[model samples]
Target: MKIDQLATRACAPPGLHWPAPAAAAAEPAARQAGAALARQPGQAAEQALQFNRDASLQQVALDYLGRLEERAVGVLQTLAARRSASAESALQGARAGLERTLEQRAAGLGEVLDGQLRAGPATRARVQFEVAGLASLRAVQAAGAETLLFSVGPQAGGPLAVVLDEHLGPARLLRRFNASLGQAGVQVRVEADSRLLFEIDEAAWPALREHLAIRGEGRLFAATGWQVPPLREQSLQAELRQAPAGPVLRALGEQVLERIRAAREYFQQQQSQLRQQLGGETRAAAEKRRVALDFVERLNDAKTTAAGAPSHFQLNARAASVNRAIARSALTRRSVLGLLA
Candidate 1:
C-alpha cells in the first residue's frame, strides 16, 4: 500500500473495516513508509550541505576583502608620512605596493567567482561582487597615454634616430617618441605651446643626447649677416633631470584613496546582501528539518497502525486472565488487584 493510504487508515474512525494483517501486506507497507521517511531527511540533509558550502564561501570572500583593505590602508599611511620628504625611492615603493594590491583585488574577485561556481548553481545565481571603479583604474594604469610615455625605454639593439614631423601635433609627437624609443627610461611630455619636452636621467642624458640625433624642419632665416642655415636641425634640446617625485606621489596617493573608497563601498553592499541571503537560507533549512521530522512522526504512526489487531485466541486468553484476576482479588481483598480486575 502507498504511504498516504496507510496514514489515512491509521487515522480512520473506530469500527471501520481494515484488511487482515499478513507478511505480504505488512512488508510492502513498511517498506513504503520507510522509503518516504528516508526521502524527507535526504532533502533536508542536501539543503544543510548546500547552506554550509555557501557559508564557507562567504567567509573566504570576507577574508579576501579584509586583506585587500588592510594593504590599501598601509599604502595610504606610507604615502601620508612621506608626503613632504623627497623620498623618491620610498614613494616609488608605495606606488608599487598600491599597484600590487589592485592586481591582487582583481585576482581575488576571480577566485571568489570560481569558488561560487564550485559551490553550486544557487550560490552562483545569488552572489556577485560589483567592481565599479576598479576597471577604470586598471585601464588607466595599463593604457593611459601619459603612463606609456613615461615608462618607455630604448629599443633592443641601439639608440635609433627619430625624424620629427612638423605637421604632427603634440600628442602624435609623444606617441612617435614611444614607438621609436620603446621604453628607454626617458620621460616625454608635451608643453602648452605644442613643444615636446623630453627628460632623461642626468647621468645618461649626455650620451643619449649625442648619439640619438633629432631631425626637424629648420628653415633659413636671413639676418644682417645674410647667413644660410641648414634645412634640418640635428640636435634637440632636453632637460637633464630628476623625476618630480613629490607631485607624482601625491597624485598617486589621491588615486589610491579614490579606489579604496569605491571598493569599500562596493564590498559593504555585497556583504550586506550576503548576510541577508544567509539569514533566509537559515530559516529555509530550519523549516525543511521541521517538515522532515513531521513526516517521520506520521510514518511511524502509519507503521504502527499497519501492524493490525490481535487474534481471536489472544482475546480469549485475555478474558481468562481477567477472570482469574477477579477471583484472586475477591480472596485477597487488595485494592491493586481489584483495580486490575
Candidate 2:
C-alpha cells in the first residue's frame, strides 16, 4: 500500500478494523511492549495492548509518510524550477517579438513620410506674377476718383472694383484686393519696393489669364511707371526646392509617428508586466517549497518521538492525530503542475 493509504488507515477512528499488518515483526520491542501490556487487568489489559499496537503502527506509517513527502517535495521543486525557467524564456521571446514589430512599424512610418516629402511638389501647382510701380498709381481724372477693375473668367458677373485713396499704401491696397478677390482663388501681397505680387492656382490661372482684365481709370498703365506684368509660372522643381511637405501630408506623418510611439509604450508595459509576473511566481514557489519542507521536518520529528516512547500513550495519540490532519491537508493542496492545468 502507498504511504498515504497506510497513514490514513493507521489514523482511522478507534473502532475501525484494518487488514493484517504487513510488517508486524519488524519492531520486536513494540510487539513485546504490547504483550506486556496485555497482562494487566480485565478489559484494561486489552485496551493497553491495543494502544501499544496502534502507537507502533502509527509510528511506522508516519515514517513512511515522511520519506514519501520528502521525495515528492524534491520532485515537485525540480519540476517547478524547470517550469519557471521555461516560462521566463517564453516571456523574453514574446517581448523580443513585440519590439521587432514596433521597430518595423516605426521604420515603415518613416519611409511613408520620406516618400510624401519627396512627392510634395508634384501634387501642387502655383503661379506668381508681379506688377511694376502699381503701388504709386494715381488718377488721371479727379483725385480719389480712380478705380481699379478686376475680373476673372469670360462669362463672370460685373467686375469687382477697388477705389484708390490718396493715402492707401501697398499693404492696405493688397489687403483690400485680397478681400475682394480671395474667393476667386487669387491672392495678392506686397513685395519689396512696394511692388504687388500675385499668386494664383495654376489650374485656375489659365482660365483667369484668358479673360482677366485689370483697368485703372488714370495714368496707372501709362509710361508714368505703372504697368501690368504677365503671369510667371513657377516650375515644379523650384516649388519643391522652396516648400516643405504640405500641411495635410505633414499631419498624416505626425499621426503615424504618434501611433508608433504609443505602440512602443504598450510593448514596454507588457514586458514589464511579464517580468513582474515571473518574479512573483518564483517567490511564491519558493515560499510553498519552504512550507512543504518544514512540514516534512516536523512530521519526521513526530515519528522519531513515537518510535522512542512506545509506552507513552499521549504522545502516540498526538502523532496519530497529526498524521490524519496532514493527510487531509495534503488532499486539499495542489501542486504547481495541477494549478497550471
Candidate 3:
C-alpha cells in the first residue's frame, strides 16, 4: 500500500516517448513525401529503419529501469529486516548483562552488611569507681609530743609521727591534724560540726586494705576528744544490678538489619529475573528495575547505620563493673574516724 519514492523516480511516465510521439507519427508521411522525390528515395527508407531501431532500444531501456527499481527496493527491505533482528538481540543481551551486574554487586554488599550486622564481640577496658553515703567522727587526743608515732602497714612501711599541742581546742586541733594528714597523702573530710567523713578510693583501697595495721597507741584520736566506736564492720561486697541494655538493643538492631538485607535481596532477584525475561529497551522492565534498585540503595544505607551502633554486650559488662564498685564503696565506708584511730 506504500509507494516507493526511488521506484517512482526511476520509472518513466506513461504516454510519453523518448522521441516525441508527434514526431514519430510524422516520420512515415515525411518518408512518403521523400519517395515522391526519386532523387532521395533510399535515404528516406534508411532514415525510417534507424528511427524504428532507436524506438526499440528506448523501450528496452525503460523496461530495464523498472526491473532495477524493483530489485533495489527488495534489497533494502531485506537489509532493514536483518538489521532490526540484530539490534533487538543485542539490546536484550545488554539488559541481561546489566541485570547480572546489579545482582552481583548487591550480593557482595549483602555479604558485607551481614558481617557488620552480626559483628563480633569486643573487650571491656574501662575501669569505674562509684561511692555513696557519708561517714562521720568526733575529735580525739594524743598523749605525746614528737615522740608519738603512727604506722599504716602491718610491717610499718610508711610511718607517720605526730606531736599535739594541748592548748589547741578540739575543733582547731582536729582541723590541724586533718591538714597534716593531707600532706601525708591521706585525704579526709570533716563534717557534722564534729564528725569525719570518709570513703577510700577504689583504685587505692585494695592495696591499702591488704597492709592496713594502723598503730598510734590510741593518741592520734585520743588527744582531740574524738570517740572510737568499734566500726560496724559492714561487709565490703557488690553485685551487678541493672545490666547495660546494649544486648537487647543489639539484638533488635540485628533483626532490623536482617529485614533490610532481605528486602534488598528480594529486589535484586526481582530485577535480575526481569532483565533475563525482558529486553533492555522495554520501558516497563526498565521502570521496574529502577524502582528495585532505588529500594536496594536505601536499605543498604539503613544497614550501614545499624552496623555503627554501640555494642550492647560490651556496654553491659562495663556497667556491671561500675555497679560493683559502687556497692563496694557503700559497704567499706563504716566510719572515717576508725581508720585514723
- Relative to the true structure, how large is the alpha-carbon lDDT of every model? 0.43, 0.45, 0.37
Over 1-341, each residue of candidate 3 has an lDDT whose tens digit, in order, gives 13774476459687643433444454465445334333322443443344334333333333332343343233233333445666546534433332233233222232222211221112111112221111323334324332234344443356555455655565665566456444434444455574554333323444444443333334444334323233221111111011122343234333433544554454345334433332332343246345534543443344335443335664455345434433333232212112212
**Tens-digit per-residue lDDT, 1-341, candidate 2:** 69999799889999975533423333454445334333323343343344334333333333332342343233233333445666546534433333233233213232221211121111233456554435322322224445767767654566776666666655676677788777677888755554466777655666876766566655454323323445444332223233333343234334433443444444344335544543464455456445544544454454454443234675465445444433433332222212222
* Model 3: per-residue Cα lDDT at residue 326: 33
Question: What order do candidates take by TM-score, descending?
Answer: 1, 2, 3
Worst 10 residues of 1 by lDDT: 231-240
Where model 3 places Cα greater than 4 Å from the true spot, the runs are 1-148, 153-157, 217-341
Backbone clashes in candidate 3 total 16
What's the lDDT of the predicted structure labeled candidate 1?
Answer: 0.43
Q: Regarding lDDT, does 1 or 2 come out ahead?
A: 2
Give lDDT: candidate 1, residue 173.
Answer: 58
Q: Quick one: ranking by lDDT, best first?
A: 2, 1, 3
lDDT of candidate 1 over 1-341, digit per residue (tens): 79999899999999997664543465576467456544544454554455445455445555664564565465556656774555545656765654555445334344333211222222211211111111222222232233111111253354343444445454665576656654554554544553334544334443444444322222211122322221111110100012244455455445544544554455455546655655575565456545645544454445456655446675455345434433332233222222222
* Local lDDT at 235 for model 1: 15
Question: What's the CA error at residue 10 for candidate 3, in Å?
Answer: 79
| TM-score of each prediction | 0.38, 0.29, 0.23
